[model samples]
Target: MAEKTLAGKTVEVTGEGYLVNKEDWSKEIAAELAKEDGIDLTEKHYEVLDYLRKEQAAGTTLTIRKVGKSGITDIKGLYQLFPGGPLKLSSKYAGIPKPASCV
Candidate 1:
């Protein structure tokens, strides 16, 4: 784990930049993370983030197909919203570990 400052608070994160402690997450931190990723975090983005966080807390592994079925957004929309790596980037901003399926 590595330490980083976010939303004016110190938090633990993995080497890949995923949050180590889910409790350390906040909307402010999400906003900062999104900014770093070049995302503006619209309501549609929040919908996916909310879904990802909830699924993560429930021990569900995240995937682009799953996210598409989430009713938050479709696969194309997700890619458009997150650009490069949708699930990975969204999970990072949502403060969850990198899903095993990511790589």
Candidate 2:
């Protein structure tokens, strides 16, 4: 399958939401995305990524409050990290087929 692009793509809302275009996912873009999601893009951001990956591995849904409780500190961080919020970020980066709750 062709790699996906996170820039203009809409985020999924279910399952493991990993980014489709892992190859196209650049550090700069990641940072920009993080900024868009309102995250500072620090080691803390990795916590969110790790959580999403883990949730995917376990086949579960990732909630924003749960993510924030996981150490995100700021709940509104989603606004910056994901323009579409938790569902979007999780689905976009988790690589899930397509989040049902993203819309």
Candidate 3:
């Protein structure tokens, strides 16, 4: 896992590839998080993140195939964006506050 300072706090990567902290975040924080991952928070990214978060919250898991079905075509391209793959990257980078088992 990787660690970095974001917004003056320590952001630690968890098993799911997301930075976990004891703070609740707003939409702006989510955008800032995407920037940390070098991902531009476009509509597509936001949509996917939103869906993934909702799914995780609802006790479901996602996969690259699901991501592609969600309207993202370039799974291979995401390798550079998220070395741990879409599940980790999206779950982590989206700042979804949930446990891996919850998904």
Best by lDDT: 1
lDDT of each: 0.89, 0.54, 0.61
Task: List the candidate numbers ranked by TM-score, top first.
Answer: 1, 3, 2
lDDT of 3 at 72: 54
Candidate 3, residues 10-76: lDDT per residue as tens digits? 6675654455653444456667676766776666666667777777677667666566666554666
lDDT (Cα, tens digit) per residue for candidate 2, span 10-40: 4322234345544444445555555545655
TM-score comparison, 1 vs 2, better candidate: 1
Instruction: Name the better of 1 and 2 by lDDT.
Output: 1
Model 2, stretches more than 4 Å misplaced?
A: 4-40
User: Which residue pairs overlap in candidate 1's backbone?
Assistant: none
lDDT per residue (tens digit) for residues 1-103 in model 1: 8999998999988888888889999989999988987779888888888899899889897799999998878899999999999988999999888888788
How many backbone clashes are present in model 3? Answer: 1
TM-score, candidate 3, is 0.58
Local distance difference test, candidate 1: 0.89
Q: TM per model?
A: 0.94, 0.51, 0.58
Displacement of residue 93 (Cα, Å) in model 3 is 2.3
Give the Cα error of residue 79 in candidate 2, in Å: 2.6
Off by over 4 Å in 3: 1-23, 71-84, 97-103
